[model samples]
Target: MGERYLKSVRLLAECLQGFERFVAEPVRRHGLTHPQFDIIATLGNTPGMTYKELGERTLITKGTLTGVIDRLEQKGLVERARNCDDKRSFLVRLTAEGDTLFRNVFPAVVAHGKQLFADYGDGDFEQLDHALRRLRTRLDTPGLVTPGGHVPADEG
Candidate 1:
């Protein structure tokens, strides 16, 4: 049973790594790193979001996020403005140039990535999504005991 779960974990890691490598080339062609593209895609079609919100929405950690935002700001792709509702926080949004880039590059990159799933049917997608969500929910649940009948150290 443990071996089965371990195999799944290995496969999941491999899948994530492959997906990253597959999408990375298109992102690089746009002159952006994976994290930068993630931020741009997250902020695209949206008004703006605070740093906290961005951190929550993105895979980037708060520490790395500041640096990524700084680089984007330097490239004139994004700007930070004082949040009207919260004077202590700043709202980050794409510049006009950034929006244009997002409009052009986003769909192209998405299309390129979608090619990976070209053969996947709707049912395949549904099954995959359901399985992943179920795994995530189980992982997030508290007080889950291990095979040894004790809560994992992190869970405890």
Candidate 2:
């Protein structure tokens, strides 16, 4: 069990680090941090989303989201409007400049990232994808003891 844990943890970390290295240059060239790019990418195609939805989609925590959005707002890239249905929350969306940036950067970054995997056959991708989903399911099972040495309150 310990060996399985170490291998899986190291494998996931290595994959993430490789991808970050692959895409980091392009993201920096666009004058954005990795988290900023993540928020922009998540908000790209939609009209808008609430902070909660944005956080979920971007995998960014609330505290980080607010600061990132603040910087983006200062750059005149993104704007937030009062969520009419939920007066306490805001609907965040890209401004015209942001939309332009997204149109350019999204495809550029994706192309660059794809180049790293260009040699992989379709079946290779499929196998990895299947394995990742299986691992995610196992990790999300309730009552499972996590690396923290306590049962997670919920799958989340």
Candidate 3:
């Protein structure tokens, strides 16, 4: 049973499906992709971050982030300016419109996110978070490499 559960790709796929469906309507209503919203939200917290830093924080690759930035720029949602401190890098900042939109939509987005886990009480959520954090730390440690924590593996 344990082996069957571990090998079941359906479980992971369904989890991803649930997450995608949960956010699909709201993201579409806001005229944003999930990644776009994630970038904007990260920028809202850390203003004037370079594209590299933004990519790191958003977990978006450079190539993908460039496209997102281009779209946001065309939409007048984000502005890319020369980084005064680092001439080699471009600083990404939210425009006034972007700021206003984020401010308006963030609360609703947060509420909707909360609704995703509404079935879990605070205690359960806390415990889940703690366990996940531990798992992350273990998997992410630089020096302690294990097969499971190494390069992506195909369980299929």
Candidate 4:
């Protein structure tokens, strides 16, 4: 049981790294880092979002999100403005150039992802998706995940 659990954990971690590598290639080719691309992609085609919204949607940590947003701002791809609703937080929106870049890159990256998932058809990933979602839920749920990072026996 221990061996199997260890192997599954390693495989999942490696698969995540591999998937990031696969997606990062085209993003890098477009002269943007993964985080920058992520910011642009999330902020695209919207009026704007607050730092809190962006953090939630991007799943990037506060420290990393701030730096990534700073870099994107420096590149003139994103701009910040005072959030009219809240004085403490700023709203992040793409510039015209950023919108153009997002329009161009979003589809291309998605197409690249589709190519990678070409072998998967309808109904192929439903169970896997459910399993992953379950795992994420377990991880996020306090007291549901054990000290050793395993889900509760009842869940298992």
| Model 3 TM-score, all chains together | 0.79
Prediction RMSDs, each to the true structure: 2.8, 2.7, 4.5, 4.5
Of the two candidates 2 and 3, the one with more favorable lDDT, higher being better, is 2
**What clash count does candidate 3 reach?**
0
TM-score winner, 1 or 2: 2
In the range 1-156, model 1's lDDT, one tens digit per residue, is 667789988999999899889888888998999889989998899998999999998867889999999999998989999998879999999999999989988998889889989999999999999999998998789887788888788553
Q: In model 1, where do residues sit more than 4 Å from their true spots?
A: 144-156
lDDT of 4 by residue, 80-108 (tens): 99987779999999999999999989898
Colliding pairs, model 3: none
Task: State, as a TM-score between 0 and 1, how close model 4 is to the true structure.
Answer: 0.83
Model 3 ranges with Cα > 4 A deviation = 1-13, 143-156
| Model 2 whole-model lDDT (C-alpha atoms) | 0.91
Q: All candidates' TM-scores?
A: 0.87, 0.89, 0.79, 0.83
**Which digits, one per residue and each the tens of the lDDT, describe model 2 over residues 64-114?**
889999999999989999988879999999999999999999999999999
lDDT score of model 1? 0.90
* Descending-TM-score candidate ranking: 2, 1, 4, 3
lDDT of each: 0.90, 0.91, 0.82, 0.86
Model 3 lDDT per residue over 32-104, tens place: 9888888778888556799899989888999999999999989998999998887999999999998887887
Model 3: how far residue 90 lies from native, Å: 1.3
